[model samples]
Target chain A: MIKTYLGIDVGSISTKGVLITENREIIAHAYLRTQGQPIEAIKNLIKELFKDNKNIEIKGVGTTGSARRLAGVIVGADVIKNEIITHAVAATYFYPETRTIIEIGGQDSKIILLKDSVPVDFAMNTVCAAGTGSFLEHQAIRLGIPIEEFGDYALRAKKAATIAGRCTVFAESDMIHKTQLGIPIEEIIRGLCEAIVRNYLGTVAKGKDIQPLILFQGGVAANIGVKTAFERALGIEVIVPQHFLIMGAIGAAFIAQDYTQKTKSTKFIGENLLDINFKTKTFECRDCTNFCEVIETYKNTQIIDRYGDRCGKWSEKLPNII
Target chain B: MKVAFPYLGYDTIALKKFVELLGAESCLGPPLTARTLSLGTKYSPELICLPFKITLGNFIEALEAGADTLLMAAGARKCRFGYYHYLQENILKKIDNRHCFYAISQYTPYEFFFKKMPQIFGVTPQKVIYATWLLLHYSALIDYFRKLIRLTRAYNFYDAQKKELEALRIIENVSSFKEVQKAKKELRKIFSPIINTSNEIIRIGLVGEIYLMLEPFANYEIEKELGKLGVLVVSKRSLYRHLKHLLKLDLFDLRTISNAYKYLKDSPGGEAIKTVGEAHIFAKKNIDGIIHIYPFTCMPENIAYEALQKLARDYEIPILSISIDEHTSKTGLLTRLEAFVEVVKRKKFKG
Candidate 1:
């Protein structure tokens, strides 16, 4: 009887899932576009993960990423952790000696500092969208190139063009200006990678203590040119783990395994939970003048979890989800 | 007048030393009790820092306790601390406590206190020298204590050093810089043997408007309080810092200077650059946390806030944002401060 653990990462742009066996082998994994429907995406993820592993008994379930709460409610996730914790845990579990983590996703960029397999500090770029994968994707479409070929084109460049990468506004204008100057496409692509790396250095990693033994994970890790740019900028090699894109899901599974082993009870609502109805609503709280925007999760008529209240006034009314 | 001075910058010793020098008795509010927070919260509107609420609560308590004058420090430039005296005066008037608010002007209406020779215990020069000496001692003590707290690995050992330093507040004879220096040296010597002086604890740079940083009543005195929880704070005299910023604004072109560059985009003041430079320095130092404070509706700080967040991300340090205004409450501010401190501590210990 191969014992398995389920992990789900429900993010704004994508929902990812992974099923791991007792030996920490990824038995099943699935990636699906969330399309602004986390509930549906998670249901689809669970459906795909359970497609082949009919005999595999799930010991526990974990959820991570931005929409962890919503995923938790939908998937009956036993462990709900933040992306920073989940990513660091996964990186450390695999590499063991990972020090810095450079995670650039479609919508966000994060720099996680770790010492001895534990997260020391982390910085996430939520306000600025300039150095993220979506920014590169937008630029790639504008440059008449597929996003996948971006890395190869960048590597082929003999000389780099200077692209203003401070903000999207500045970058667009500067990119157009550089194009007007008749820079080669390869040079421009290389310049884009450099600009991203430079922007990341100037913003996300500004005051952070970025030591060596860095791990680059996320959708953007597939880009060799960006990886090269990071290596050049930091003068250090970045290790991209085998399961870089699904590391969050893997980390969640690992956590689930660890947690369920101790609790000895499967809190998972089971795969049949896909049929449950759920909705998320956000409202501004007028309590105490902070006006905290509280996000509420409802299962039909019953409220499952309410968060985003900075003072924990509204969250206090809900169950201890943490 | 049996004046009551809410401890803002520095610590109990700084207030004690000042009270001792003034030859005037002070109605010392209890050690930032929960009651103090409630008072602020009850009276304060939302959206202001916790420190402001607590201070107002302390003021209300002091007035009820028969204290007439509330000694405070004022500033100038874009930092909202400059308007503290003016705003507080109005708030108090509306509350109708009728207590005379005698602020020790650090900048705004700077001439009103120094040049006009405001009376203190019927002695002008004596008050001036006394205030100056106390300020110097407080500045030195804060710098040393924050460093000490950060460097020490053993929590007990750090507490021991703090206890020794705090014990000096009861002494009423720090009338000169010589006395202040003596007190500081003795305290440092007591801490030298105990604190892990070798370990450089993560030094955080708190760059923003001054009011929310210095006035515990405004930002919940988070810096010093964080020190109690083993996080060392680095902050200069709020008034002095803002004054230098004002001089730079007058001297440099509003558009060219980096310190006030943010202000240049909207207005022509050098305060924005001053804030940016400070944020840059903090980032460059690779400080563990950069807790930025700003007053609500403060345009210059808002500009700096945008730039600082970017810097925080780039520097890889934890940054906490705090906005203070007339409506801010003490409890709300304290909760944020607690969370911020907890995050920093968790990160430090885990790392």
Candidate 2:
């Protein structure tokens, strides 16, 4: 059987999983909406991946994204890394000369500066949604356009309208006002695409070096209008990698491949996890004044993981893993 | 008189002891909590800094707890902290007219020790002098314990936390100078065993507003959070160091001040000078990063934030500036801290 690595990226808005051979060739992949339920999404993703690549023997597994810790526990990942490191590693793997990475995910955006195939500097948006894919999705729905076609509308604009990019509230109101002024729909869409690019540059990528060989990845990279806007704003061509949407998952697979090679074993629980009944329960721990909200995941009524306790009163009870 | 003071981190115990030594019942406001912050925010101007709001809450709680007299530190060279007492007194008097409030200037220690304190407590100058000396010693003990806790918490968090609680209990029970000396030895004994000299830890410098630097509650126990991330925190601002600097007993580091001149030629009031100066120093010392914290609506620290950002770029040192207020969530703060620790670790690895 060919050795393979599995990578799962469970983000707030979506869950993506990828299966790769030892040669770093993609064997199978699945993407599904998390819809606020990461465990269910991961299960579905795993089942989908297994349906296509049943013969491949999983040697290692890794997880990344906001819900990485939760995904790692469910999958028994050999490596659990943050999105910043995983994205950087995957970008370098695909484009070795990549100097900068611009990632606009569902709810957040980040800019990574790399030197010699290693991330030297990085910054993420702090409590801002003006420059993310979700913001554009929301605008698309409000304008009665499918999010998938929002970029095509932007590309057809005769002249891009200018919208405030500093805040989502301001930008939305400005977009509405421009529409009321009878600005063309295509122009308004293009304006929003530019606004997102401008906001991302002004906030997340602010004061950082944005050099050549810049790769834009994540959910927002599918928007050709935003891609063009980024190119126009920076006066440099921004390349969106082939596996743009699944780059985080691919990066995680690379990490798992490296880790399992060194350890000579994997902690992966295998495709049987698809059939396991995983339940999550959350309660506020009032033992201390902090009143931390503790989340516990149980597999078939057996507690497998506990987290979110600041004092570690609950998490410390479980055997350490990941 | 039943005297009380605002809780300023661990130094509250020392202040409480000082009040008790002056032949008065020491009533500290309830330890800062969510209730205190809410109470403070309710009565404070929406645009004022966090320290003002929290201290206002402390005075209100103390008065409600039947404390007849409230002692609040009064003035500084630059910053709205100087006017905090004046505004708090007005606000408290408006809320209730039964309590007596005194504004003790932190900058004028001699006048405060010999004149203001003696008059308020109706004590002799000699007794006041002795109490002040004892307060200084207690402050030093607390500062030493803070440093020790920061160091040990990085390696063994629970043990350091337990030891810190024990140290606080010792500090609270000490009355005489002899007891203070004994308490110091006992604290050393409690903390000595937890010292693990591991060279594999990252060192971070914390700088910003005096209140945020000294008060864990205000900054969401950031030093402890960093410690949990295996970071050795070196904070230059503390109540003990502030007291020494105010008294002119501690020699000013001219080198740090000169380093600040490269970024900020003059003090912009508050702790801006120290914030910038310390960032330069931390960069020179090759520290992992600097976490700059200040209250929302703080002008001096806002200026310092800009200078620190420039310094961060120039030296390639990562700096995380956190503006805290009543609405600052613990999870949000922790996320930023985790991301920052990752960044610092990656930078260290590359270097």
Candidate 3:
């Protein structure tokens, strides 16, 4: 049987899965919208990733993203990490000289500065959603342009119209105002792209040294418009990796490979997790005045996992908490 | 009379002992929770710093717990913290007028420890002096307790947490000055087993506003979180140090100011100068990284944030400044912290 590692990233907006060979090669990959249902999304993505390979034995599993804990529990992952570390691992692995990484996900934008393949510093956009995938998706819908074609229209612009991008509310109003001014729709779209790049650099990437060999990953990298804007603004080439959308999955796989090789064991429950009925429920714990909202993940009838309780009264119970 | 003051996480024990020795029953506001924060937020002016809101909530809870005298530390000319007690008293009077509101001026060490406390507690100045002495010693004990907890937790968290609970019990039961020393010994004994097999541990310096530094709830138990991530947090800001600073007996003051002069020419009020100074010290000591946390929109800390960037560049150390508000989500904070730990560890391993 061929040895392989499984990596899953369950984000707020999307869920991604990837299978890698012992030599760190992509064997299979899948991406699907989470749509507020992470469990189902992971299961569906799992089915798609593992369906094409039958002889491969999963040696280890890893999970990352906002829903990393839930994904870890679901897959019995050997390695669970935040997106920042995972993203950096993948970027530096692909581009060893990568000095900076620009990652714009569904609701957050992050700028990670690396020196000699190690992350030196980083920053995430705080309390702002002005320059993320969701914002771009919203503007695309408002302009009656499919997000897939949004970049091509941006490419069509001869001269981009100026649009405010400091705040989402302001950006929306400015976009509407530009539409009323009869500026070409393509120019308006291009302007929106530049505005996003401008805001991202000003806020998330502020004061961060943007050197050569920068890689832009996450969901927003699919937009060539933003990529082009970044290149023009920074006067540096931005490389979008072959598996840019699934770079986090790739990184998780690398981490899992490192962990399982050290421990010589795999906790991965297998890719047939679809047969299990998984559900999660949250209840307010009134044990103390804190009133922490305790969450429990159930496998069929038995409660398999619990969290969110600060005092760990519910979470510390091992195996079957109930 | 039952006395109450704002809670300062585990440091509450020392505060309680200080009040009790002064001949008044101590009633600290119930451990900070969402309910207290919400109650405090309801009456506070929009855009006020988080410390103000949380302390107001503590006072409300204290009054509800039958505390007859509310003692709040007051100061303002250097920072907005001075006006906190004034505003809090005005708001608390509307909620309950039966309790007396006393804004203890913090800068006046002699007046506060000898005159004010003696007058309030109907005790001799000599008794008040002893209580003040105990307060300093007890605060230092807790400060040492925090360090032990961080070191032990970073060494091995699974066994270290239970020892922490037992250690807190030991710290709380110390009533005499000698017992404070005994408690410290017991704490080291409780943690020594777990910390025995300790290996390479990454160290991060935590320096920011004094209130944020001392209060675990205010900073969301950041020291504990970093310790759990296998990072030994070297945070020097403590209530013991603050008291020393207030009394003009702090020996570390000269170095902090000289360091501040490297990045800043003058103080911008509050602990902004101190923040830069501490970050400078942490950098020179070769800390893996530095985490700076203060309330969002805090003027003094914001100035410190700028000086910190230049310091980070000069020292080539990663400094993360987190501006916290009521809306700061726990999940977001964890993600930032976890990523930061990875960054620092990676940097250290490379070197």
Q: Residues A1-322, candidate 3: write the lDDT tens digits.
A: 9999998999879899999998999999999999999998988988898787888999999999899988888878998989998999989989999998999999888988899999899999876889799888988888788988888999989989999999999999998998998889999889999999999988787767688888999999999999999999999899999999999999999999998999999988876678988899999988889899998888888887898877667877855311
Question: Which regions in candidate 2 have their CA more than 4 angstroms from the true location?
Answer: A320-322, B178-181
**By lDDT: ranked, best first:** 3, 2, 1
Q: Which of 2 and 3 is ahead in TM-score? A: 3
Q: For residues A72-178, write the lDDT of model 2, one tens digit per residue.
A: 98989999888888898899998999999999999878888777887766777764678687788888889999989988999999879999999999999999999
Chain B TM-scores across candidates? 0.69, 0.96, 0.97
Candidate 3 chain A weakest lDDT stretch, 10 residues: A313-322
Please give me the DockQ of candidate 2 compared with the native complex: 0.34
Best candidate according to lDDT? 3
In candidate 2 the C-alpha lDDT for residue B85 amounts to 86
Docking class of 2: acceptable
Q: Residue-wise lDDT of candidate 1 within B1-351, one digit each (tens)?
A: 677777655454556556656677788655454566677678775655444566777787777777777776665445555666676677877776657786666444445435533465554765755575455556555556545544442343335544644534522345566765676676676566676546535455676665456665456555554654556566443533333343343332332245434323343232555566656665566566777777665667677767766665556566766666554554445434544554465577773
Error of 2 at B115 (Å): 3.7
Give per-residue CA lDDT, model 3, range B74-124, as digits (tens). Answer: 884678998998889889999999999888998787897678888899999
Candidate 3 lDDT score at position A148: 88
**Per-prediction CA RMSD (Å):** 11.2, 2.6, 2.3
